[model samples]
Target: MMKSKSKILVLDDDPNIVEVIVTRLESMDFNVHGFTDPGKALDALRKDSYCVLVTDQKMPEMDGMVVLREAKKIDPDVEVIILTAYGSIEGAVRAIKEGAYDYISKPFEPLELVTKIEKAIEKRELKQRVRFLEQEVGDSIEYRIYAESPAMKRTLAIARQVSDSDSTVLIQGESGTGKELIARMIHYESRRKRRKFVVMDCGATPPSLIESELFGYVRGAFTGAIKDKRGIIEEADMGTLFLDEIGNISPEMQTRLLRVLESGEFRRVGELKPKQVDIRVLAATNADLEAKVEDGSFRPDLYYRLKVISIKLPSLRERKEDIPGLVQIFLSEFSRKTGKKIMGIDKRAMNMLFNHQWPGNVRELKNIIESAVVLCKGTTIGPDEILLSGIREQKEENLNTLESQEKNLVIQALKKANWVQKDAAAILGISRRVINYKIKKYNIRPEKVN
Candidate 1:
C-alpha cells in the first residue's frame, strides 16, 4: 500500500463521488475524510488541519472557488484541487487564480488524480520544511546578551574581539556558566552570522557514533546507514560549529578534528574523496584539557590548536555581584512564561539565593527561579517559595554571619551609592534607619570600609 502523512479532505456534493474518492484514497493508505455538504467541509477545515483539500467546483451551497479561498485563509499552506464536471480553460484559470493547486476534469482517471494528490502533498511538506527552517533562523538569529556583571563584560569583550577572526576559540568554564551563550554571541556578532550555528555535544554522544555524527557517512557505510547523510561538520559549512564538552571526545576523533582545523577538509565515512568546508570552530568544556594531556588521554597537538584563543569563564560564586540582577531577570522571565504575577522576591528569599554556592551555576539559578514562580501564589516570591538544597540543613547562624549575603549586599550598595547611608538605602529600597541598623550590625567603620 502507498503511504502518506497528509490528512486529505475530499468534498463533492454527490454522495457517490465522495464515497469513490474517499475509498480510493484510504486504500492507498491516505488518511482521508469525506463531506457531501460544502458547509460541513468548510467547518472541518476551520476546526481541524488538512494538507490537501479536494473539492467539487459545482455545489449548491458554495462553489469550489469559494472553498478554495476559504481553505487558503484557514491555512495558506493547504493545497486545494478543484474537481468539476464543467472543466474549462477559463474555470481552471479562475481556480488557479483563486489559489487552487490544480483543476480536475470529470471522469478523470483515478490514477491521474492520485498523482496530482501526491505532488500536492510533496509541495505541502516542502513548504512546512521551509517554514520550520525559517522559524529556527528567526528565533535565534539575534545574539544579544543582557548580562549584568563585569566578569561577563570582560568575557564578551574578548568574544567580540575574536568574532571577526576565523581563529578557533576554546572556552573554559565550569558547567552551566553560559559557555555556549558566549559562543553564540561571537557567532551572531561575526560576519558568518547569516549562516547556521550548529551545536554538537561530545560528552553526551557515544564515541562509536561520534565519528559518523561529526563527519557523516554514505549509504551502507555501516549497519542501518540506509541513506547518505551529511555530518555535523558539513552542516556547519561557512557557519559556526560549537562542540560542547570537547574534552570528552575520543583520541581518534581528536586526530580527525585536528586535520579539519589544519586543512579545512574531511571525508565522509566509506567515501574516498574529501569535501572542503570553511567553518569556524568553537569548543567548550568544564574539564581541564591540560590535565587530560598530562594523563595522555588527550592529544597535545590538538589541544594547542584548539587553545589558539582561550577564554576562561568564572563560576557563579565568583560573580556574586551579578546575583541580584540575574535573579530579577530570571524572575521576570519565568513569571512571563508561566503567566504568574510574581513581581518581586522578598529579601530573605533573595538572600537565600545569594547564600547557595550554586554548583550548577546560572542554569541552576534560572531553574530555581522558574520553580519558585510556578509555586508562588502571591504577587511576591517569599522564602517559603524559594526551595534551596543546602539552606534547610545549614544552621541559621551561618546564614546570618558578618560576611553574609545581606551584609555583602549592603556593602556593595553602599559602595555603589558612594557610602551615603540614605543613598545606599535608596539603592536597596530600604529606609535610612534600616541602613544605619545594618551598618552597625555589620560593623561598618568608615576607614575600614574605605
Candidate 2:
C-alpha cells in the first residue's frame, strides 16, 4: 500500500507555469493543485489544508506577498514559496521578509525547486515536533519537568511507580534541581490528587513559628493568636503535604513531625485534645540529611521515615544533552509571553550553553533563555545575545585563553553590526574574508536576518 502524498497548492497567472509546477510536484509524489486565477487558488487554500503553497509574484487579483499573508492567516504553520521572474527579485525578497518560506527565481531548474521544497517540508515537520513536545509538557497533570536524559527518565519512572502508594517520598538534589516540582508531580499522580496539596517551606519559616505553622492554633495560643486557625497539616487532611527543605527544620520540629508520620496524630497549640488526620507526606531537600543525622542536627528516625521511597534528581550538568530540547521549549514559551518572533538559537550560542556548568540547574537555564529572548533583536538567538556573567566569572582562568578572547571579540563585533558579516568585519578592523574564517574556526553561525 502506498501512503498518501502531502498536499501542495500552486498559483500563477500563466497557465503554462502553473502546469509546469503542478506536473513537476505531482511527478515527485506530491498531491498538487494548480490554478491560473488567484481567486480560485485562495478559495482552495481556505477550503482545504495544505502542507505547502507555491505562488507567482505577479497576478491580476493579488500579488504573491498578499497570498503569503492570507495563507499564513489561514494556517500560520503552512510553508509558502514565492515564484518571481528575474526582474522581480525585490518583490520575492519582500515576500520572504513577510514570512514566506523561500523564494524561487523564474526559469528555475526542476531539481533545484524540488530540493528547496523538500527542505521547507523538513523545517515544517521540525516545527510540528517542537509544538507537540510543548503541548505534551503543558497539558501534563504532573508538574512540568522537561527532561530527555536517561537518568531523569529513570527517576521519573520510579516516581510514577511509587505515586500510587502512601509511602513518604524524599527527593534529594541540588538547589534549583526541581525537587519541589517532583513533589507536586507525586501529589498530582497519587490517589490524593483530588484533595488539597499544601506546601510548607521548612528552611524559609522561622524556628519559633514552625510548630504553630504545621499544627493549628487556638485563640490565645500565642501573643498574636486571636482566633482558632487551621494549619497546613489540617488543611492537607485526606490529601498530600509537601515539606520543602526538610533538612532545615529544628530537632524539636523533627520529633513532632516524626510523631505525625508514625501515628497520624497531632495537637494544636494551647489545646489538649489530640487531632487525627489521614495524610501523605512528600519531603524534599538540597542538604545532606544523612550527614545532618550523623552530626545530630537532624534526627535519625525522622530521616529514615522520610526516605521510605527516595528519588534523587540529576543536576543540569549531569543531563547536558537535554539542553537543546529545554532551550526550544523555553524559547517558545518566552516568545509567546513577550510577543517576540524569536525563532531559534544559533549553533555557537548552543555550544556555549552546553559548555557552561549550570550550578543553578534547570532554573538557571530557564532564566538565561528568558533573558536572551527578551534581549534578542533578530529572528534567532546568537552567542552575543546570551548573558552568562556568573558562569564566566567562575571560569575566569579560562578567560585569558586565545580562543576565549577571540570568541568574545567576534561576538561583540557581530552584535554591534547587527550580525552583518561585512559590517561586523569593518567594525573589528578586519577583512570580510578574515571574519568569515574566524567565524568558521570558532563555529559561530549567526541567525539569518531577512
lDDT tens string, model 1, 1-450? 124546799999899999999999899989899999888887777644577999988888898888888889777889999887853658867898878888788888898899999999888766765664575456442233555678877887898899999999999997668888899888878987766788998866777889999999877889998856779998787789999999989888999999999998999998888877789999999888999999999999999999999999987888888888887887777777788887799998888878776655776676567667877889998888775211242455555642475666567667756788987776554467657877998898668867
Superposed model 1: Cα runs more than 4 Å off: 1-144, 388-450
| lDDT assessment of candidate 2 | 0.80
Q: Give the RMSD in angstroms, all C-alphas superposed, for model 1.
A: 16.5
- Cα lDDT for residue 294, candidate 1: 100
TM-score of each: 0.59, 0.57
- Clashes in candidate 2: how many? 0
Question: lDDT at 365 for candidate 2?
Answer: 74
Residue-wise C-alpha lDDT for candidate 2, range 1-450, written one tens digit per residue: 011336788889999988888888788788889998877887677544577888888887897788888889877888999999999898888888899999989889988888877888777767865764464357442256787899999988998899999999999997668888888788778877756678898766777888989997877888989856678898687779999989978888898899999999998898888877789999999888889988889999899999999999998889998899889988988898899999899998888888876656777677678778888999999887875322242374655554565566667667757789997766454567667877888888666312
Worst 10 residues of 1 by lDDT: 388-397
Off by over 4 Å in 2: 1-142, 388-450
